[model samples]
Target: MHSVNTRTLDLNLLVVFATLWDTQNVTRAGERLALSQPAVSHALRRLRERLDDELFVIGRHSLVPTARAMELIGPVREALGRLDDVLQGSTAFSPATAQRKFRIASGDFVEFLILPRLIQHIASEAPGVMIEVVPLPANNALPSLLENGEIDLVISTPVAFGAGLREETVTKVSLLTLIWQREGLSPGRFPLDLYLERPQVMIEMHQREGNIIDASLRAQGLARRVGVLVQNFMAMPVIASQTGYICNLPGPIAQAFAQTFGLSCHQPPIDFPEPELFAYWHARFDADPGLKWLRERIKECANTSDE
Candidate 1:
């Protein structure tokens, strides 16, 4: 087998070698790689001289690699992949002293309920870290965005995957509760039918497919006419404050929004499942060290907010 003079090679030559072997012709490889064809040809000549054999030879309008070139392909590709592995593996998040730009996307309720404390944490711990909160999308492709390096991380309860996606539960929310006039309602949880029938109001994302109110009502063979339809949780307090309408929302969400809107919250009279919030990442970043640090900081932020 032909051998290369290992001592006399620059590291980037391996990249040139791999590209030529994959495409065979230097001209085609250069075109594929956006290099001048002559540069690729010159690179190949240097590789041939350094290796003591022509790596490829002219064939019918193509270039055919020599036996040594074919033998080197697998190992060369593996080496490049390993290099990537070495470069992208670890994390550090000492928020008390970190400087980073963190991007997040979620509903306004989560913004109101959770993020205030996280911001405070950053202010104290990683004063250099800045938060860029994005408005919620109807159906965000967060996993893909993570892979493509668009958004850094996602925070929400709902998470699913086609592939290469992961979500770790950041927090589990309490069941939906009612936000009613503080003076009139019973002190404890309300009765389902009474709560449902008592001039109910619903808040839903405008672009969301269907509201839980509609689905739940249909499931139990019962339905309550919605007295109000608003897009954001921000309005739940304002609308529910003076009106007798009861707002059905996640306990934490209702409680938080109520503070802002001057309303109140309680467990619904009926039983319903609680929602969850999670931090999701793409597997592509599974080995990314910087990402690991970001995840930890986010987890810390979310966890500390609960306390």
Candidate 2:
């Protein structure tokens, strides 16, 4: 065995290896790679020498991969696939017939607002494409998930991602106060005094003991009485509906909940910053055609806010 410096290795050899791995026959592999049979043999020879292994051997009708070649094939194939994707560019993004999977990280608020429309659009137009929602706390939970290629995008309030990350505004969503119609709060508006006095149901987006709403309220030298705490925005309506508790939820989620659970939506009296949901990705994927297409679809779906 020899210690080969990868810096001096020809990447073309991996292509030869990949082509040979797929086709098995030297002639077929050479035809696929647009190389003569001799050129393919030469490339394989170099690859074998560099790796200090007989990567493949001539069988009756096909080349048999050595145990070492079998071990390297998976990563070699993956690398070549990624390289092909890169070389193909945005022109190859045909959602209609493309079979691809996208991983997105976001909370229930964003999911509740956009998933149905997004899913329907994908199902109707890009039947073969798939969307996987990597649940949050996911964005914060896995610090290196995006950088390591574990997830494609992050949809969240502009959080600090240090470097090699890019964020694009998906949508800005204003906060709305949600209360049961039975609570008898005035429609269209919630008075600050009544809001402070009412028992509130809080959605804990972060794992912290307190919520952003409480932090905002404290900044204004005021506090609301939170009587219950739920994990996601979806549960807020359920708790508020049955318990007559007021909850501060995103406008889109509140609107959906209002229609479904007979809840009332009111503009909060206190001044609060609207949460801008941003689509974040690693800088490496900034020019990726597939992710670009996915991002556009996400933006379309996220553009649900009336405000």
Candidate 3:
């Protein structure tokens, strides 16, 4: 392969290529870039001539990337991201004047705890900014999502993120046992034997061999019966309120649910460690002012005093 001259290459074509790869339809790509269909086609032709390969081809309805396009996309995205960071770094970030969108991946709990305050702050301070919250990807997919710029930040419980990520502990949350207003149970600390006797509502976000509570119980040769297993924390409160089962949830969430469902919150009989919530981001954007500002805002919101 002959070396192509970088001076003769139009860097703008790479932007077009990335857009095309993302949209997969000429009209859609043109709409995203504010370019006409003919202009986009001409840019693709120029790129093909420069690289001596047809990077994409017309499929049944949309364009499909060739192996060459697949090979180029990763590096192309990285290059563009770095270039964006460099350009953004050159200017001071003014939240009041800047029009930007930040995407965050997190669980429903984070949405409940943080987003309301964050949105209020944004509305008052940065009317032009927008926040999009997406469901957290699986643990193994997190690094790629951050690296690929698919998500700007992640708010989650501590997890082992492999590499190229930065993390900071935002807050530590203790668990509160939520139970129905039973005859024997009171509003204070629950009794150990009573807690052990009652069936529990378990919140399992991921399918795994075992969880921290179970592992801790196993060490002491203790186990509780699970009456219901659920994927969503929001459902746990409803199930706990209606049934004889109990659920352990973060303090704020449990209190909120207790108020809404007319349930009772009690201190768990057993001592369990508080879980720390962390904010994670790609290390590549460590110096990006907008992300930095957003991270601070998230931290502040997470640490807000309970009402």
Ten residues in a row with the worst lDDT in model 1? 204-213
Write down the TM-score of every candidate.
Answer: 0.64, 0.70, 0.78
Candidate 1, residue 44: lDDT: 80
- Candidate 1: give the clashing pairs: 90-289, 95-125, 95-126, 96-125, 157-276, 190-269
| lDDT by residue (tens digit), candidate 3, 104-125 | 9998888988899999999999
Listed per candidate, the RMSD to the true structure in angstroms reads: 9.2, 9.4, 3.7
The candidate that achieves the highest lDDT relative to the unseen native structure: 3
- What number of clashing residue pairs does each candidate have, in the order they appear? 6, 0, 0
**All candidates' lDDT scores?**
0.67, 0.79, 0.84
Q: Of 2 and 3, which scores higher on TM-score?
A: 3
What lDDT, from 0 to 1, does candidate 3 have?
Answer: 0.84
- Model 1 lDDT, full chain set: 0.67
Looking at model 2, the pairs that clash are none
Ranking by lDDT: 3, 2, 1
Q: Which has the better TM-score: candidate 1, or candidate 2? A: 2
Q: Clashes in model 3: which pairs? A: none
lDDT of 2 by residue, 1-307 (tens): 7897978989899988877876788899889889999999899888888899999988987888899987887567556657766777647578888998988888877777778888988999899999999785544544456744678888887787775578889887788988778767677678888889889887654425445677788998898886887777778888888888888787777786786887899998876777788888876566577899888888988785343
